[model samples]
Target: MRHWIWVVAAFVAITPFTVNAAGAEPVGSAGALISGKSPDGLGTWTVRYQHFDGNSPVAAVINDRIDDAANHEVQHATWNGSTRRPWTFDATGTINVRPTTVSEIFVGQYNTDEPNMPMQSLGSVVCDSRSGTVITWDNLFQDKTSGLTRLSAEVEARLAPAASSNELRDWRRSGQFAPIDVNFKHWVATPQGIELHFPPLQFGRGLKIVTVPWASMSDQITPEFVAITE
Candidate 1:
């Protein structure tokens, strides 16, 4: 974790929002119907995000995703008082791939006053370096159907060792590798391949990563994506 990404903040007005296709990130609790309050005032949260050095739209999108991810504590935490339970949050991301352009990914986790509800959130976004448009799985491969089919097969194979439970196996087939936008939400483009981030709570225990290598899917991957990753 870089020092810049370790900085804490609160309700900062400049935080960027997510793109339409990227979808709303899952929050800790949303302060949802869950009643709660901190005996102490809402303690300040430790929020940190990956700082992009560039000013391009790609940078903007990544920063926004990080900002949104880090706020899960303040926006969704639960307790029973005027203020939500005291929670601390931290997030980090990186420009993992820059084939024809740049792409980024971010993940966050928080510790809270509530015992049962430990917080964990993961988010990732990839954008066109020039246009700034949110890029999806369909965009990474030239032939959407074949691309996904191949990627799906490859991803499942790689995750075989980690898919220890039936729940994980089902999600791997239906959700994680599904063409659904949210399914691939937590991912990054990498020169090595498309690296996935699966938070333990949802997938299993510790974080699990399964990379679909470019060499295995080169024939169908978008040329732009293969240029740098392969």
Candidate 2:
């Protein structure tokens, strides 16, 4: 717990936010879009950006919109070091649009009462441009039921060796494992196939990313998904 205090302190020290000295102005406005690209040209993306907005109702509405777009739940807590201050909402992410598909990734964090515990998670949304529809794991499979069955088996098999590892052990102890169905919402389209992003504590601290090659699941994949991802 002592160690966590330091961790939380560090996060607070670095998290960039504007403070109003007179407390008359809103801490910051919401609903800004930030865009960028990888230096190597591998990907280009945009972030639906916002900063900590002090308890303004307008800020709350903007926060809700950001949360809904990212498919994340709001985290509540007392702002550290200030009992008068209320919890604030801040979220940002990237959307990479390719010729065939679009991949969006969002990371969110909020202060919590637990020492060193900031509620944080990552989520992704992939879309097939041709159909102008969001792609789900079920959409990729010819036999959705059987395909999920196989995917679960394969993912478990791949992770079996690491069952005793610290992260997996913690996750298992916490009873968060759902071996029957793998979450497919957080994925990115690639030339190889699709890369899945599992956030911290789902598999471990830090992000757990696995590339499921198209060759491995070609039989199960629908032609439409194949055309988009490939």
Assess candidate 2 and give its TM-score to the true structure: 0.57
- Which candidate number would show the highest TM-score if scored against the true structure? 1
Model 1 accuracy (lDDT, Cα): 0.54
lDDT per residue (tens digit) for residues 88-178 in model 1? 5554444443634445455556666666545566666665655555667777778887777787677677776755678666776556667
lDDT of 2 by residue, 1-230 (tens): 11112221222211233324652222233333433322223223333543324375543443444334443322111112223222333446554555666555667665434465555666666656444466777677888877766665565566667667765666656644443345544676777666767766677677676776777778888887777645
* All candidates: TM-score: 0.62, 0.57
Alpha-carbon RMSD, candidate 1: 10.7
Poorest lDDT segment (10 consecutive residues) of candidate 1: 28-37
The list of candidate 1 runs beyond 4 A from truth reads: 1-10, 13-43, 55-84, 97-99, 143-145, 162-177, 223-228
What is the TM-score (0 to 1) of candidate 1?
Answer: 0.62
